[model samples]
Target: PTLTAGTVKGNTAGAFGYKNTITTDNSYVVGSNSTISADNGMVLGNSATVTGANGLALGNNTKVANDNAVAIGNGSETAAAG
Candidate 1:
């Protein structure tokens, strides 16, 4: 079952923050303005985003845009899969 705790979208669980969104199953997002758009993605921190399957983004302004990618720390971005 999906468990959403704040303003969010999609079939996901453990989302808890304002304006956070998860667009695929098995995704989790936390922090304001965060978004996860792929399956098995996880994002944490303000303005973090995950756009690829099995991606992870952590810290403020972090982004992971490729499958199996991970981005951590503020202003981090992943450009290739790992």
Candidate 2:
């Protein structure tokens, strides 16, 4: 399944606020308002953003904007630009 149980926003519009699906194969987004826009991306906390493939965001309001990037802790962001 694309989404398992207890997903606050799964396969439903207006929860993620983006055209892309909330979670794709090899991708995992596990928080309210988090986003993953590419493959192999992971968003682990609330309000996180991952715009690049193989990116990871792991806290509230964190952002990973480039490919093969990782952001850990709260509000962490990758310096690389997409």
Candidate 3:
């Protein structure tokens, strides 16, 4: 069961944009081409991605790739877990 406005798949996750996808429980994705693939992850900008549990990515092309990490600002990326 997912709440979606675009391409999405997850148990109780939400995705709301073109090509957005959430693939883990309690995750959320928004903006075009964004993706969230871990539990409690969230992405909220174009091309943003979150690939670790409890991670967050916010801004264009931002990425969070470790557990409890957060990436903010355009083109930002996390280099280590939080």
Which candidate leads in TM-score?
A: 3
Q: What tens digits encode model 1's per-residue C-alpha lDDT throughout 1-82?
A: 2244454455645687777777788888767788888889988798998888899888999989899989989999998633
lDDT of each: 0.80, 0.67, 0.82
Residue 69 lDDT (model 3): 89
> In candidate 1, which residue pairs clash?
none
By lDDT: ranked, best first: 3, 1, 2
What lDDT score goes with residue 73 in model 2?
A: 97
Q: Candidate 1 at 67: error in angstroms? A: 0.5
Q: In model 2, which residue pairs have backbone atoms overlapping below 3 Å?
A: none
Model 2 misplacement above 4 A: 1-24
TM-score of model 1 (CA atoms): 0.82
The residue-by-residue lDDT of candidate 3 on 3-73, one tens digit each, is 44565567778777777877788888777888888899988889988887899898999989899989999
What TM-score would each prediction reach against the true structure? 0.82, 0.68, 0.85
Positional deviation of residue 18's Cα in model 2 after best superposition, in angstroms:
14
Error of 3 at 78 (Å): 0.3
What's model 2's overall lDDT?
Answer: 0.67
